[model samples]
Target: MSLEPKKSILNLEAYKPNFGASNLKKIIRLSANENALGYSPRIDKELKIGGFNRYPPQHSEELIKTISKIKNLDQNKIILGNGSDDLITVIAQTFLKPGDEAIYTEYGFLQFPQSITVAGGIKKIAKDINFHASVDNILKLITDKTRLIFLANANNPTGTFISKSEVYRLINNIPENVLLVYDAAYAEYIRNDKYTDGSELVEKYNNVIMLRTFSKLHGLAGLRLGWGYGNSKLINYLMAVRGPFSVNSMAIEAGIIAMKDIDFQNHCFDFNLKSMKHMEIELEQLDIKFINSSTNFILINLLDKDKFSAKNAVLFFKNNGVLVREMNVYNLPSHIRVSLGTEEENKYFLKLLKKFIRKNDS
Candidate 1:
């Protein structure tokens, strides 16, 4: 007989990425909430010189030091990874044991369940209130077997977020042994006043960790760079389990340049601010139902489930050479997520969307 894989591995479905057309040059990409302004010019300047022979620095020292300054956290609290997903895997390996449970909200990141399953842990889904993570619902599902919780601050698919006060309440109530993984992948794009990204809680409590990524605002998705901030003990444990030299030397150099390029950072921030407001105003004028997003995207609710479903909207945008995310996989059949692009791209998306609405809806 052939060798059989573990049952946990067998049961897992391969992650389906966006439509293949997403990669084509013809389409205007608004599906992946990427930085529309693109990467900093400084990255190119740094990468022209070579460092291909040696392995990356063991701990990503210089990059972490820069992040420490911006975050006002100790370097000991930081753990760098190939990407935030790598850290998620490390947490699963470090904390989740066979038959133990991990909690995620109903519409949490797809990666959470995959990470849990790969680690041989039982996954529990806590129902959300409307589209936002309901802390109360999450708390109710916490049995003694629960070892971890993953909350997406400035959540994806649905661009809603909970306030810092609410996050504090959740932390105060969670059992001390259970760890909270705050997936703040979109934290940099948030312009709200009340959001925390869970850093304050991570500082005060040993059980909370804040995970951030360079993929979004820093325009370093190609580099696959991300980092986490938590108690020194927890950070040390993750570092112990993580692979050596996961963050390559090239990525390390690019990350340092991107972090220090304050001009580019400000440019991205200003563009997003202008575009998000524009999206809200235009969507309302067209009578489109959309979540007021705190991040770089908006979730348009196509209330006419049968006539103008999310699938239909996807096809419509795809036909027009614009790429937006379909939400059926997220159990949101009537909603589509659109990332804020540059001014011209945003206007084109609005134009095509308005035309689609008039053609189908009217």
Candidate 2:
């Protein structure tokens, strides 16, 4: 017999990131929800790496300690991964058995399905209300087989979020056997008073794991550092499944400095808020419909799909040396997700977008 991969792995769709005009001399990339202001300058000055010859700490102890101090969490209850994506996959592997079901909203992060399917779990989708993760709908999808629920607060692509009350409602309703994988990659960007990042729930509930990443606010995407906080028992299970030395020394060193760089983090947050607001106003003035964002990115909704579909808009932007996320992967064929960029980058993107609109009109 010919060698073949598992059927579940065969059925999985690869995650595609927006790689805009890499060959271009200068391309404004606002596709991936990356930190526009870039990473902390303190990382450059303060980060030290001495042991290149040996394997890094298996548990990323120092990094975890730093995160624990900053977030006031139990270090024993925290687990580090190569990135949040790695943690997600480990969660699926540790929890899901063959034919088990995991629920996520319609527009949830694509990694949820990928991880679940890879772990031989059935993927269940709850319909979102107006691109928002609806608590009631997610609860309705529960069954004897459901083992995990993946929810991204200040969700990517749509950039919409549910409040703390709604999150609690979901938590209170879901069977304790079912683990809620709360992905809070964008938590650093949220200024809303209602958002919780779901860390507190992890403390109270044994079945909940709150996932976080330094990729976004800390501008450590390239380094691929992320972490999860949950009950000690749950964290222990994840740590058992997590690869030894998954987190490298450079990432650990950088993460420690990045976590402590409060000034740099605030700067990124402030800049994102201001730039996003400016872009929102500009989109309104141009009569372009877009979602009100709670995170660093805005979702530009091209309502009249026949005239200005996301596919066409993405092509236009790419041609004009501007890269933005086309949302067809999330089944949002008429929308594009634009990450907040530097002032000049934002202006250039708007200008090109305006020009694209004019061209479409003409």
Taking all chains together, each candidate's TM-score versus the true structure is: 0.96, 0.97
- Shift in Å, residue 143, candidate 1: 0.7
Candidate 1 residues lying further than 4 Å off, grouped into runs, are 22-25, 304-306
Q: Per-prediction count of colliding residue pairs?
A: 0, 0
Residue-by-residue lDDT tens digits, candidate 2, 24-121 = 78888889888878899988888786879999999877888999999898899999999999999999999999999999989888898899999999
Name every residue pair that clashes in candidate 2: none
Error of 1 at 276 (Å): 0.6
Candidate 1's displacement at residue 228, Å, is 0.3
lDDT string for model 1 (1-362, tens) is: 88878778986888775644544568888988888889999888766457689777889789899999877878889999999989999999999989999999888888899999999999999998888999999999999999999998988868788999999999999999999999999887776779988788987999999999999999988889999999999988998999988888888888888888989988898888888998999888877788888888899998742478888888889888898988887788889989998889999999998888888856
RMSD of 2: 1.2
lDDT of 2 at 236: 85
Candidate 1, TM-score vs. the true structure?
A: 0.96
